[model samples]
Target: MSTVISHRLSLLEDTNDQLKQQLESLFEIGERNEQRFVWLKELVLELLITENTNQLDRTLYSKLSELENIDDVLLFIFVTKPKVKLKHIRDTSLSEVPSRLVSLSKTICEVCRANEYRSIFNVSIDSSGSFALIPYQFKDIQGVLAIGSSEPARFAGRVDTLFLDFLGEVVARVVSRIS
Candidate 1:
């Protein structure tokens, strides 16, 4: 019957539409991934060529400052042996951190609510803000790199942080070399 054939055609058309939408979304994700790769490559190159810890700090800050969603970037490094003393190191000591919070060996990228993580951040951020904390280690050097966003939902939950993890690794290697 023509009615049956029309119903079948409608079903097929709906499926086709869904597939098209999925493909378009995939393309968009691909474009975003490509951009991340390009920027990450450039940042790694700059960090590698940086001469000293001061220059390294500037380079790292500049690279992270360029991110659109992030309002703040904080780097906490406890230099055991001073290759050159860092000027802006926060006054907080390792004793300030709770033992349960920093199991550094297995620490990974985390998205946290600013209000709940208030104890960790020295600088003030909106209680409604959010943060992406990426942990890194290089031999004896271990530190956390935090990026804050004014928008509460910007870093909510365990969203995709693949690029951030890669960035942390690259930073660890660069820190080992320079600091």
Candidate 2:
């Protein structure tokens, strides 16, 4: 009977040890994810601040140039006719902008205009990279902020749009002020 009790205690101890290791591993992963989230948020905030500066296009290009993952950041503002107004190409080697990204930005702008929503966030992946289009409305004018990432999995499973939504609002305010 004593032997049986001792064996049961040993099994419980081993189980507790495994659980402790697992909990520690989970905490480490959580901390890493938290740091990533904070970094992303900071990048977005920097973009907003850059937009507020007098030199909008140059400042924006410089701000985005610092980010390695971002391939390109395009700003399309709706006018009498749809057009790609401002494009900041990260890679200087590219002769021209990719047609697919241009098309995607136009489509996103059209959707936002048709819906007349305050903001819309859309994401897609292609052979080039993962793309995110954030369309925002400031009064009558509609604009799309398109971001392209070389990492295919960068935007995967990112269902939470809180950051993007906040970014859209800030962009709309800035656009309104400039216009």
The candidate scoring highest on lDDT is: 1
* Candidate 2 lDDT over residue span 26-113, tens digit each: 9999997797678666655665665432455665556555656665565655555333334441211112333333344322212222
Clashing pairs in model 2, backbone N/Cα/C closer than 3 A: none
Error of 1 at 148 (Å): 1.6
Which lDDT tens digits does candidate 1 get at residues 1-179?
99999999999999999999999999999998899788888888997797776787677778876877766666666454433434323323455443433555533434555554565554466566777777778797677776677667777775677777787787778777765
Please report how far candidate 2 places residue 69 from its true position, in Å.
2.2
**Candidate 1 stretches greater than 4 Å from native:** 81-93, 96-101, 104-118
Q: For model 2, state the Cα shift of residue 97 in Å.
A: 13
Q: Least lDDT summed over 10 consecutive residues: which range in candidate 1? A: 83-92
